[model samples]
Target: MTQLAIDVPENIFSTLRLPPAEFAREMRIAAAVQWYAEQRVSQEKAAEIAGQSRIEFIDELRRRRIPAIQLDLDELEAELNDG
Candidate 1:
């Protein structure tokens, strides 16, 4: 596992009304959501990156009004056929 370090100015915390820890957590979730929304990563991987369970990540996606399903036409058809 690789660790990433971001240097944020202390004043930004005040502006966001969040503590450093909370802000870091929010950023992690945001990154996970963005990557997942873009289909750049799988939901499981995104959940791991966000430090959340699969269900929690899916809930978060719903909360953000982003579709949790990423299947395209071919994939959807295959899934429908298999079901």
Candidate 2:
């Protein structure tokens, strides 16, 4: 991956503190969380939007303390078998 360097004035940067790159990451995370909570988009779809893999998306959800598991009884059994 390639990275770009950005420059901002000290006062403006200090006021926000978060760098632009970090801010983008946080926004992506926040959007995923909100979409899950309110809009209830599927993990795969949300992950796609966030530019993450399914597992990574799930971990991101867990990091934010969201319950990332949603399975029916059949799905649970399937998961158990797969595990």
Candidate 3:
């Protein structure tokens, strides 16, 4: 795995009231969420990037109200009509 180092302003942690490690963890999850939302990565990849299991990642998506399935209106209609 590749490691990245970044410089963050000192006041950020105090302002957010989060420890450095916790802040970094949240940033990773946020990045994964954005990439997944934009269709830039698969669910598996996003989960890996978020440092979470597939099920956990899916649960997080649900909690955030993001759709797990990416379907268009026509596809949704067809699925609904299938009995």
lDDT of 3 by residue, 1-83 (tens): 99999999999999999999999999999899889999899999999999999999999899888888777799999999995
Error of 3 at 32 (Å): 0.3
TM-score, structure 3 vs. true: 0.84
Query: Candidate 1 — which residues are off by over 4 angstroms?
Result: none
Each model's TM-score? 0.88, 0.61, 0.84
Across 1-83, the per-residue lDDT of candidate 1 in tens digits comes to 88889898879999999998899999999999999999999999999999999999999999999899999999999999999
Candidate 1 backbone clash number: 0
Model 3 spans > 4 angstroms off? 74-83
Clashing pairs in 1: none
If both were scored by TM-score, which would come out higher, candidate 2 or candidate 3? 3
Best by lDDT: 1
Tens digit of lDDT per residue, candidate 2, span 1-83? 56545665667645778876676676677887779766479888888767789999889889888878767789999999999
Better of 1 and 2 by lDDT: 1
Estimate the Cα RMSD of every predicted model relative to the unseen true structure.
Answer: 1.4, 6.4, 2.2
- Model 2 ranges off by over 4 Å: 1-16, 71-83
For all candidates in order, the CA lDDT equals: 0.95, 0.78, 0.93
Between which residue pairs do clashes occur in model 2? none
| Residue 12 alpha-carbon offset, candidate 1, angstroms | 1.5
